[model samples]
Target: METAQENRLNPFLYLTYLLEKLPQLPDPQDEKALNALLPWSPSLPLICRVFTPTK
Candidate 1:
């Protein structure tokens, strides 16, 4: 079942979704720190389709 929290955030699920993608990031460990600072663009969905949105 989907969590109630996911329902609260629209467009994107939450930062957890963003955090999960950190490991796959191409940047070095040091540079990965800036990942969160990256802008959210249409390319976001390309990272992980799993957490995009059920509906």
Candidate 2:
């Protein structure tokens, strides 16, 4: 049996795995379909923060 500490996974590693599996831009329109295909979705603020220019 694995210990809790041993079972722990790095969030950044998981995020990288998820991003690699996600569809390219111009995804499906249906929310259900999108959710079914995507492991995660960033909120509007998070998306804006990532793309927004740094001054």
Candidate 3:
């Protein structure tokens, strides 16, 4: 049987750890320019589908 402490360390905790380690956001003007310069990517659609609200 799994211990209580081990059970508490779940996937959500790992996700939070990953988010915390990400680089800080850039300036809004630069961010907008970067997005405009970048090509359309399928990553956003995949992530949205993963976290989409279920009916």
Candidate 4:
């Protein structure tokens, strides 16, 4: 059975789909280096943070 959220168009789902089509990412430990190399591009956790609602 599909939940309400699943029925709706979710940004996370789209992001996941796009990510799945991309090449494999570096190790989590390399996040800092990745950030330095591509400040404009956000990591998975950072992407989640942007989508999350702040209290």
lDDT of 3: 0.35
lDDT for 53 in candidate 2 is 56
Candidate 2 lDDT over residue span 20-43, tens digit each: 545553664667545543323332
Worst 10 residues of 1 by lDDT: 1-10
- Candidate 2 wrong stretches, greater than 4 Å: 1-7, 24-55
**Stretches > 4 Å off in candidate 3:** 1-9, 24-55
What's the count of clashing pairs in each model shown? 0, 0, 0, 0
What local distance difference test score does each model get? Answer: 0.46, 0.40, 0.35, 0.41
Model 2 TM-score relative to the real fold: 0.29
Candidate 3: clashing pairs of residues:
none
Candidate 1 regions with alpha-carbon error over 4 angstroms: 1-12, 28-39, 46-55
Q: Which numbered prediction scores highest in TM-score against the true structure? A: 1
- Each prediction's RMSD over C-alphas, in Å, is 7.8, 12.7, 12.4, 9.4
**lDDT tens digits, residue span 1-55, model 1:** 1332333333254455666777666774655455443443334443333445567
Better of 2 and 4 by TM-score: 2
Tens-digit lDDT track of model 4 for 6-45: 4232456535744563345456456665453232333433
Residue 20 displacement in candidate 4 (angstroms): 0.5
Which residue window of length 10 is worst by lDDT in model 2?
A: 43-52
Task: Indicate whether candidate 1 or candidate 3 has the larger TM-score.
Answer: 1
Model 3 Cα shift for residue 9 (angstroms) = 5.6
